[model samples]
Target: MKSLGEVLIQRGPFSEIVIGNSAIVRAMLESGVKVVTSYPGSPTPEIAEAINSIPKDKNPLYFEFSTNEKVALELAFGAAVNGYTSCVFFKSVGMNVVADSFVQLSMMEIPGGMVIVTGDDPGANSSQNEQDNRHYARLSYTPIFEPKDAQEVYEMFKKAVEYSRKLRSPVVLRLTTHTAHFKQKVSFGVYEPSPTGEPLFDPNANGPYIPIAQNVPVMKRRALEKLLRWQEISENYAFLQGNGSDVGIITAGLPYLSLLDVLGESAKKVDILRLGMVYPLPRKAISEFLRKHKVVKILEELDNFIEEKVKAIAYEERIDVEIVGKTDIEDWIGEYTPEKVYSVMSKFSPELVRKVEKPVKFVRVVNRPPQLCPGCGHRPVFYVLSKLLREKDISVADIGCHTLGFLEPYKVGQILLSMGHSTGTASGLSMFNKDRKVVAFLGDSTFFHAGLPGIINAVFNKHNFTLVVMENGTTAMTGHQDHPGKAIKIRQILEAIGVKHIWEVDTYQQDKLEEILKTALETPEFNVVIAKHPCMLKFTRERRRKGIIKVPQMKVTNRCTLAGVCITKFACPSFQRADDGSIFVHEDLCIGDGSCMVVCPSGALEFEKIETGGGAK
Candidate 1:
């Protein structure tokens, strides 16, 4: 069977329909994107996945799963500077990491095109916060193209790249969760190869590369000039006209789709203006639309970016248009649905609007919230940490699979923040609160990404805390992308970073783990404990791929005592309890990592090799 990657890379005869994310890959391929890189994130992972899925020989683009968002943007920026079209993509919060370099990257002129995709999570669906990155485009002085669906994303991406080259600045492709995840029929287009060839760095081409104090104002002026030029040159614009209704609606991105869904036969009664190019405000186009309508309602998810601007345009242009947005009538938080849009529009057209009944399902099933996967190595670490933690001791957590410790039997992380926030915040807690001990937790990938600075903060300030570094060998949370900390042992990095006292222990070794943790708590100054273990799920798959025989399944023997220590204390998802309150191992779920065997108090769990391709005899 031909893989999705194979279909995406084809030079000709593309599929008739594709998902929103696949369309982005198709767009990249069509545009002859020389380099594609990203830090894996939800609603945007499929773009990189499609590229990585294609065989190296079949795929023309140089694709990389960068260590972090900042590195991904910088890598793509390097490619762009050397005259190769490049793309860097990440989720909403990921932009926070990239923003430092991105702000500076905006000031430079690029010979080759660059497109930065920001997959914003408006509803906080799979994210910690719902951030509006349209402000990033404004802050960076970059033009942004907001695509509504798969087809628009495909078409706008091509335009965005060209505009980036033309404007000599990176263009932001703003995608909400709905737009990126939404599946729709995208008509295929012929691949148009990028004009530039393989990039070769030129030592002599150093004029625009230097961003000294003197060039700061010069770059800012030039960026402003380009923005002014873009307002006129870019033709990828949209404005939906109604049948001369006094009440007009202005929206952009996915919210425009919501407006269309609710308009339903009453569309002719109102004017709708959907702006694809959100930044620069499309003042010329918007002013014209505002003059035609008596009253305009703005519908957008999260921030009222468009609403505020449209109101300003009305005041500046001296157009008599009453703009209503984000008031008691509608909502401003999370995502905008068709029903929400309908409720707002119904105010204008009361007779045309009718509430539609929504279907509800009442099924008797256990609530399955996301948790640590069966036999995850971090499970044991969290289990032990939860056991050892005192009421006075606080656990601070960074972004990773270990964040799951905030739930279930562990219930760690009293203070939760963004990536690398644990260490930074823990440093503050240790310094001010002398009565309590702080235990900050972060993964290997996060240590490299954002935890490094916080570690430094603690060391330099002489704050006392126990930093538990979970070295799971891969970026487990975001699909196990390779990182520097994983490549070079975290111990070496810790030593170099001035971490004098470091203890390394296998997470599965419960006795040693408990002892090491106890020592960490007892120590007065800064302490570090590295929980060294490969993610069990990934390890098992790797072993199977290498043709190694699977380990014997762990089972509950006749000596079973249903004390529930394995279930409550250890809390491995593989442990299941029968209706009679007897404990047993769900053999299919167990990876035979042997953590259960070590922790089982009654010696109930035992590992026995089964007959060839058969159950235990």
Candidate 2:
């Protein structure tokens, strides 16, 4: 099978092979986007991945995995200011990181135009929170396109780029998790490479680039003016219209699919207003539809953003239509599916709607919640910390795979906020709760993304806390994407930020780690312990890629007391216990990190080195 990149760049006289996410990339290429940057995130990672995989010669567009969303936006904004078509993408929560800059840029002019793709996970799938970012468009006074599928994503994204440049502002392309990941047979156009040129910033090209106090009101007025103009254009965008009927359904984004599926054949009896432009309400079109229909029902996920607008429009126009929105039948949270829509629509027409059947047998499978992978180096560190802290002390957590420490076996983190708020939150706790010990935990990728600011804030405020930098050398939670601080030691960054009393220890060195942890807790000054370990999964994959395969192995070897210490305390997935309580190693799962060897109290586990790549020595 061709990689998403290959398929995207291939001359597509071929039909129906491209996925929704790749279609965005293909559209970017067709739109002549010169620069693309993103912080790797679910539902949106494939966009950056596909771009990164394109051969340099085939498509000369510049691409990068930025340190964080803010940087990603800034880089794209910089390119856009220089008259280069640029785009930046991230998941919904990541928008919070870029929000400050995004709001500011919205008030400025971009000659080359910039497209911001925000992937919203309505179900909280693989995310800390399910944020509705359609509000962002309304907040920023920017035009937004919410594509229903891959083909729409392709067509709308192309138009978005052009619209951005034409309007001299950034355009938002809101992609929900459903649209970002769901595959469809999208008929796509061929990739057209952007014109070859060295992109440079012409300072004078776009004047008043900065957002100052003097320009704030001017920018605000201009934003409103543009929104009004775009609202008229959106009214005529073809997707906003409905069939002439007394009963109508108004929906946008992924919910539109549900509306269609639920209505099915009866859809012809009712008029439907499918909104591709979710924000800056297309008032003229919506009012006309309301004037025609006696009842208008709104179906949307997460929030009543569209519903509220529809209501206001109906009232403003004195259209005597009954506006039904956010019924109790449909949940205000989670992604909308066909079944969920049917439940809502059944309230109106029970005879027509199909009932969602509950599974008869309901065979309960093994409950396998996500855990730290087998051979994860953070396992040992977390084990020791959980032992030391117990349930008394507070361990503030940040975003990463290490956040798994909040789960069972190792209930390390008691409080978790956004990406970089851990250390800052710890600082506040340290100042108030002088008697209690405070420890802030964050991963390497998060440390770069938002952790640095918090660390600096902690130091400046003279707060007392011990910070554990889980240096796993990769963003393990969201694939093994490289972070800036991963390669360059974070200790240097900390020292420069005035955080003294820093201790670095290999995660495998349990004794040294314990000593460091004890010292950090004892010390009054702000302390940082760097538990450095390469993520075992990434290490193993790298070794395989290099064809250098010898790995350390271990066995329980009949010295087993069956105390259940390793199984219960360590919780490393590599250890498998039989029904008889006999513990053994699963060679397939073990990565030879050897951190577990130190924790085995019975000395039953013995390390055996494998001579070759494929087998045991």
Candidate 3:
């Protein structure tokens, strides 16, 4: 059978040819990382998905989209203790959510080499905080390796296992968005399984599994002692070296690439040292390099991580090499654009000017910052549910791509902090009044994520509220990534949850959708609505041009006077407000997907026309 890598390559919107990062692929195949887990965010997702799909042989395979970052980390740590060389991953802020579990994992040292891959998003385009996570490795005192690009990412994975097994520490391989997402030539090779040693049971040395009063202090000491070796490892860092230093710049990961790109050919003259191992300051290697340099410049993204470490090492060593960094230079924490890096360099030495070109604005296809899809299934699902709101609706939402539901037309999602809080929040809201309809909506991904436990709580505790699990097969909002419900029937999940009154609906079918929903409202039974369909735009929009989505047509009958009640309360962007304060919809914008037809209580708003070039025929 073809490897899973072949599958993604055949089906993808990947920028580069998907063949580049096969080294990591080969490593997984070799190591047999049987337990794979992730919080379905970007950059790090590919590794989780690819590792999970690896042909499970004798391996007791389990792959999951953990509800939130914290839960995902907990699962991976649990698997590690149970004797699996498990690999768990999340984006940088993902670390923030899972900090509690992470600190626990730090307390319970790894028996097998546990690799936690945290992909840093630079430039703040996709992420909330551009705070570099190398500091987490510093704070946690976990070993960290900063891979420059895909190839380096693969190399570091192999190294991570070796370092982890030897040190008995969980090694974090930090790859930036540029490094994680961008494809480059990575040589394909066979995977190396984490060496299965005898199950380590050192009761006297402090229990590795149990975080007891006796063991916690010992564990902390071991973690710190491992961190203290950063300088030692730096002394021999083969990757962290450059020639006779006319000017030495110490940079890590993708930031190093930007500095090199800015310098162009002149970079060959200026000594450049790239550290794949960042948190363990590699102080020995760095201090040696500083001795040879006439002047030292620091290049790190989003934080004074490397610069601060370098300065501290310099201060201790008393080596006076002028540090050019965030304090004296740029204040902003983000990826150094070519201009920014070049400007920093030009200031240091007037001769390094090749005058980097400011990029011209090319007409790149802007990702329509997610509004409801022209013919999205979620539209009708929420349409009928909105009527359940007697006074006003209060909801707690989870993260995933479905956060888009709160945007324009389907302003249904109320509060979204992180993943899987919707059900729990609804439980809290239920306390105020059973009359106040609190609807909690979660996508298939989020349902799998943090919602299941909360759902179980609601089911077990008999919480009085309606819970709607919008099981759109794909994790639509975050680029249609896979979810467990992607292939599996959502009804199966609801059944597994032991919910009796589960209502399944074809959201495309209008009358039946609202009818079932209407019955569900008064039923007072804890209901589960499995609105099943692929995100039409995710698959459909990518193929042929599906025309603008519109609601069903309702002719102006006897009760029709332009009250515009439907338009005012339920503000859908598709509805056009006329000059006379009357309401009309632009038919061309309508994809003939009649979701707006719901909540029209009077049956006034229906699909009027879907025209070619003119009004409806």
Candidate 4:
């Protein structure tokens, strides 16, 4: 069987089942995108994975995982400005990091097109927040396209690239969680390989590409002019399906799919306008649709952006229609499902509800909170922190697998804002608290992403705090993607940044880690303790690739006093407590790294080695 990368590059007149992310990759190849860049993030990481799977020799486009979303956007923008079609993508909150540069993108002239793909997480699944990036499209004066499924993900992405080039502006291809992961039989178009070789740059042609105050007004006018042009062309993209007379529903992206699923054959009694280009919406088309129907219902997730825009259009066009949007707060909270849509539509038109299929009854399942994986390296660091830190000490947390430290038993994370903000926040706490010790934890990937500046700030300002750098070797939270940390040493970066006290300790060496962490917390000045360990999952995979079939297993021995420390405080998923108050290692879950043995007060947890083709002994 061919790999996804191999299959994506296949010259087709053929069709295959592909997820939305892979379809976007195919669209990038088909659209002749020369440069591709992204920071690994949820709902969109598969895009990079698919592109990376292709053999480097066969891959046409140049791809890079930049330090952060802003840098990724800048790299792709630079390539696009220098006459190479480029693309950059990241998850919803990643838009926040890219916002500083993103707002300026539309104001600049790009001779070669640039498509900005944002995987907007509507339900907050695998995300910190369900931010609606469609707002950025309006704020930045950039055209935005939202696709319903995998096929449209391919088709609309190709169109977005073309429109970006034509408009000489960056276009936004926004996908929610569902649309990003949705799979369908996507037919392929002829692959248009991107041009190879260095991109040509003529600085003298467009002159200075700076958005200085002198040139600001003109650039703003030009951006608005491009938006106006897009508005005219966008009418063709606004699709009107079904033909109901009394009620009409306006939606975009994943919500449109839910609307269809609930309405089913009964959809013929209602007209649904699905807007492909959500921003700079085709005003003329929306106005005409509003004029035809007596009542129009808008279905969208997270925000009422579409409803507000449509309301404005209706007011301007003098269309007398009852515009219904977000009847309850619940409508704006989560992803729209068939059941959710059915509930909303049933209230609107009782007659049509009976004709359509009733939504399946929801079954309640046990809720399981997320926890660090078995043999996770971060566990030892968090466990040590939990033991050493006093209740009054300020413990700041940054994003990553380490964020789980805030949860039960080991309540280490007291304050958290965003990626890399922990150091900065801890610095503030140290400055104000004065009496209490401040400690912040962040992963290696985040250190490279947004943690460096915070570290520099702490060092420069001479803040009093202990910063724990969990050097897990890879971007573990996002599927173990390779990062700059793999090539560069965290300690070297710390030394170069003028960090005075830096201690490197193995995360699995709990005693040494605890000692180092204890001293670091007592230090009067800014200090860093580098807890080094490979993510167990990544380690296991590497070992398996090296033909090491068996991993050491850990077992709870007779020495266990049933202290519950291993089960409650350490909280390694491998350690479980039965109803009888006896603790044992869940053999199926344990990788046998023996990190848990250090935390057992009674020396109960012991490493039980398994021989080749033999059970653990």
Candidate 5:
């Protein structure tokens, strides 16, 4: 079994099974991508992970996890303008952060070509919302591609890069959660290694990259012209499939694949047009297809992007096809599945509906609520906060693993909007609600991302609220990616920002943390508390990698009176109550941090040394 890195670098006309994200990287290497930048995000982080898997010495392209999506796009844009094929990727909502520059950049020409990959979450599976980024492509006048599976993800990416270079414009490659995670056997072509030599940079080669008022009209005209050319080229583009049939199905991305899965052999009964180049609509091809079919159903996820466009084309061309988009049977929300397609297709062609064999019932599954990791660093901080804070004390939560504080026994987080909004939201709350103490929780990764501005606002305004900056040493929520905090200290930033009341304490030191919280809450000024600790999962992994086997394991002593504080209030997943009504530590789950001892009022928790086969006790 070759590692992902080994598989990625393998050359020649061989085939390997890989996920869509990995396939995109293979496509990048084959397309001779010179630079890749991204902010770690779900359904797309694996793209960066796959690139990182390749050793830095052997890696063909330059890659970096930028501070945020906007920074990531700018880095890639710089490389693209300097005559190097570049790519930047992020999740659905990340498009919002990059939109400020994205819309503007589309107006300018990219000589080296650029591909903006957006891993759209149709179900909001791991995102804040299910945004259809195809709208961004339409708004920016950029060409876009939507691949059905991992195999198409590979081929379309290569085409996208080439098309971007030919058109002298950036292209958008959109993937939903289903397509991004979908795996298939993809045949590979020979790797095209990037040419040797530094790409020459000319600031004025494209002439006036800025989009000021004087240049706006010229840039807009150029963009419109490019869009028209793309529309013409798209008419001949080999994205649509299938032949003549009165009953037709027009779809793109994952929904197309689902339609096929539902129809199976019955698909031959209807003509299917799967649009790979989704933005421009391939107006001519679509109009011709509508003319051939008496009834057409537009199957798509999230929004009626394709459906509405096809209908508009029909309306303009005066085609008499009965076009059906989102109906009462199907919704525009969530990922489309074969079952869903079957349900919708039955409305049009009941005879074509094949009986789907339902899988037999196995063991009944129980609903388990999400909770913090067994030895999470945020657990101690949240535990202490829950113990100390009054009901009137409002705690605002930012994005990260710490956001889980809103669930279960802690219930520390009252409001959460987006990443790094906690401090700003808390400021607003503090101004109006003078009687309550507003404490905003922020993670280290978020502090560098967007929290700094909020903190600065707090200091300048002298808002009376305690801001707890949980320094867990990495972006724990998004797969432990490194941030600016690895080099620069958060406390130092606070001091430089003129936050006079700053207290730094270890998160595991409950006594010190509790004392600091008490003092910070009573200060009646802008108070910043830096609770510093590395994420336990990352810390333990590093320790194991270094061959350090002996670790302190906590045990439940007989003094535990079944008071249920550890189970009810603290709720570390490690502590379990047996059927016999006795409390004990599940060694498999326990990381032996012993932070639970502080919450055990009976002094029943104690640490004991344990050694594995690798080292001495």
Candidate 6:
């Protein structure tokens, strides 16, 4: 049968079939890795899918979509602990989520081979922060390997698993976005899938199956002692060997690739000490390599992890070789591209001099903050709240799509705090300030993530705040991930919260929404108002997929009062300010949700879904 590598390149929508991660997959399959598991995330998602796509019949390596990173880690750990080689993967920030299980395996120690793959997003591309996972390796006192490219990533996985089993300790394979996403040619090796049957077990007092209390300290000590052996393994290993030169560039991860891309393959004046093992650092090997060279440049990304350790070691050993990396180069959180590497290199040496050009004129596009998409269901609710605010009741809102309430025309929300804070915040002020008129606006997604705690606290205490949940049947933010409010009714949660006065509002019905608000403001009890509608941007998208959403026309009418309020707060992309400063829906962008109808106090905005030749979703 043809190899799997040949299958993907032939038919995958892959913009480029030649990438780093793809190469790594081919290598893992060749090496006979028996298990893989992870959650899907950018950059790292391919790793999990790569393993899963491996022909199950050809390779018995079981693959799964673990619910969360912890589940993936534990499942892989269980297999590896029993002596079956396994791989667990997750994004870098996920490390914090799964840190609880991280230190324990090292404390308990692994009998089989285990590799924890972490893909660090340095530039916050699709992450919460730029965290260095290598520190986790050092904190756990385990070895870590960093590969710079696809070829290295493939080779390192085999070495990492081998090292983990050989030392009876788990190893971390710290992958970065650059290394995980790039494309490069990788040499192919052939091997049919070979399954390592059930893992072997040794019945001993201090074996992996031992109780936590009796064996943890002993395991920790053994893990520390095993660190000493890593230096020998790293130096003697052919993959990480340092060549002869006065300056030895001790580097790891993609920054090593950047430096190589900068230097190119031609010139070989300086020996590059490409370090795959980053944690417990293989100190003996690095120290020996540095001592032999006149100077060492630690080319790495983000914090000077390796350089800092190397500098300290050099100081302790009284080695005269200077460790220059972060100290010599500017420190910033970004991937090390060839341009940056070349710029740094040219700063000190003239061999790789490149010309600089003057800055070119560039147009500055106005960055309007994201508001409700054209025809969004969330807007009509805001329009009703705006009418309420303009007429009688003043609303306090929470953090969400509704948070745009504070942005313009509506400014409905006076305050926004943790999840469903508007309800409690408004309630606190309403009770103390004795303001009987107030409503709190929050999104369906926010209501799920942290709304319960706030609502539960408020309802029990009999807080007099009207909580208005914009229940759009989906989490609009974070790309429409599932939410409890989506599966279960939002009213169910409110009923459980013990809210006394409850009513549902169809945001599409302007007159009814206004009438409900009029009654809600007068009664002023611990009330719950849920506005339900599918997001216009999202709903019409489904119709467009079925080739249904027709071109909508803007009906010219004199009935429009031209309420500037719609333009201000209910800032839908579909709604634009004309030369007359009148807000009109951008017909091309409108999805016919009929939300603009609620916003026009003067009945200006109207829906006219007229069929045109074609319209983009």
Global lDDT of each candidate? 0.82, 0.82, 0.67, 0.87, 0.87, 0.68
- How do the predictions measure up, each by TM-score? 0.93, 0.94, 0.72, 0.96, 0.95, 0.72
In candidate 1, stretches whose alpha carbon ends up further than 4 angstroms from where it belongs are: 192-206, 233-236, 328-330, 343-362, 541-552, 613-617
How many clashes does each candidate structure show, in the order listed?
0, 0, 20, 2, 0, 7
For model 6, the stretches where C-alpha displacement exceeds 4 angstroms are: 1-41, 46-68, 82-86, 109-112, 165-168, 185-213, 236-248, 261-270, 328-330, 339-567, 577-588, 612-617
lDDT of 1 by residue, 1-617 (tens): 67887777666755546677888888888887788888888878878777788787667788888778999999999898888889999999999989889888767877678999999997788899989998887787888899888899998998888778767678899998888888877777787544547665664563456778887887787788888877775334856666788888888888887776776777767888888888877887788788888888888888888888889888988998788887763376768778777776676567665564478788788977788877777877888878888877888887888888888778888878798898889888887776787898988988888888889878888889999999888877767677886467788888998988899999888889989998998788888999988887788878989996557778889898787888887788788889988888887788777887877778888887767756565
Model 2 Cα lDDT, one tens digit per residue, 1-617: 77566766876645565667778888888788888999988888888677877876687678888889999999999989888999999999989989988987767778888999999998899788888898888888888888888888888898989888898888999998889986888776776555756765665655566667886887788778878878876875536545577888888878888777777777777888888888877887788788888888887888889999889888877889899887773468778888887877787666555655555886878878779988787787888887787456888888888889889888888888788899888988888775689999988888888888888887888889999999888887777888887467788888888988899998888888888898898889788999988888887888999997757777787887887777788888778888777898888887766778777777888887666577656
User: Candidate 5 has which clashing residue pairs, if any?
Assistant: none
- At residue 409, what lDDT does model 1 achieve? 76
Point out the higher-scoring one by TM-score: 1 or 5: 5
Per-residue C-alpha lDDT of model 6 across residues 1-617, encoded as one tens digit per residue:
54444543233223224456665565556555667876545568776555555565554567765545666788988887777778887778667757888867676556677888888987766664678888887788767778877767777887887778777778887888888877675655564656577766554643655547866677767777887787667665424444476766777777766676677642376677777677766667777787899877777777778878989999999998877776453655666676776666676555743433446789897787756677666677676676666544567766556566666665677655444566667767777646447777778766664467667877778767677788877655434434555457878767776777888977787678778766776664677777777766567777789997565555536776666555665566766778876656666876655565555567765556454569532
Which candidate model has the greater TM-score, 2 or 4? 4
**Candidate ordering by lDDT (highest first):** 4, 5, 2, 1, 6, 3
Over 12-80, each residue of candidate 4 has an lDDT whose tens digit, in order, gives 867999899999988988888889999999999999999998888889889999999999999999999
Query: What does the lDDT come to for candidate 5?
Result: 0.87
In model 4, what lDDT does residue 536 have? 87
Query: By the lDDT metric, which is better: model 4 or model 6?
Result: 4
RMSD of 2: 2.5
Candidate 5, superposed: residue stretches over 4 Å from native: 203-205, 236-243, 328-330, 346-351, 355-358, 546-550, 608-616
Best model per lDDT: 4
